[model samples]
Target: MKHYFIAHKLFLLFLAKFFLTYILLTVVYQLYLGGFQQNQIDGITQLVSQNTQQLMRVLDMDVLVLKDKGASVMVFYKQKYIARIIEGCNAISIIILFVSFIVAFSGKIKPTLLFICMGSLVIYGLNVVRIALLVVLLDAYPEQTAVWHGTIFPLFIYGVVFLLWVLWVTKILDYAKKTV
Candidate 1:
């Protein structure tokens, strides 16, 4: 047992770091949600909605308007509601997971912090685009909203995160080799 533990020490350490970070972040997030004022929008979801609105406007989809709907945001196109943006659609949890994974395979402190910040921004930006595109797609193809929302968009976001993780691991491995 001791030999096996020694051989897998690094892997065990990574797992411990990942879980601890994930759990801590998740608890903080839950506390944040709990502290929200009644009828107020969560900050992250509001940012996502605003970004999506801006993107739609830039893309010449000015017909759409974003309205705060208590805990969610609603996208209306020419006075007709198109889609509702909920908390789950905001991508905070996904960002948390991404950050946790990167921190687990962390290299130097500065690089790790920078990577987490940049990666989180990238994920947040992608999520805004995803939501905006989803709204447009759903409006155009209402019949396929289920397929698009449930599978395609999720797969795209997760795929990007997976690629980022792969890149982080490659860099960590390279750094380890150099240091050794």
Candidate 2:
């Protein structure tokens, strides 16, 4: 029992450091990405609108906007979810927070009040590409639109966000530390 307690204490410390590092990374990354994403989103909106008009001449549907706020694509397609993508970045933050608290309560970390803010700019980029491809596919293969919407596009877009999260945790954040 004594040995178990000691081991748990040590493990808790490592978890704490991991969590602290994660919080710092998330905050800085969020601020950095928020601005960059806005600009990219604006550009994507323009591109999608121009292209959608040229390609899909549907009687009722229209590409009203193209922008990713955090991790969502709000496409007012004839007042429906014509084209949209939800991001997990916000959810990631919550997940991290919960993990951090769990480890902390185990007598490990002191969760930062600065708050963990997962960055989703890369996810935003993926969404732009996702929407663009969906638009193209809708035009070229109208018959297959439903399939693309339900399966292919979600996989592609969410896959990108998942990949970005993996990279951020393993690569970008690590490289950032090495450089520092």
Against the true structure, what is every candidate's RMSD? 2.2, 11.0
3-108 per-residue lDDT for model 1 (tens digits): 9999999899989999999999999998998888777778878878888888988887854555565777889865678888877888999999999998888878
Give, for candidate 2, the lowest lDDT window spanning 10 residues.
107-116
Pairs that collide in candidate 2 are: none
Q: How many clashing residue pairs appear in each of the predictions shown?
A: 0, 0
The lDDT, on a scale of 0 to 1, for candidate 1 is 0.85
Error of 2 at 24 (Å): 18
Error of 2 at 107 (Å): 18
TM-score of each: 0.91, 0.37
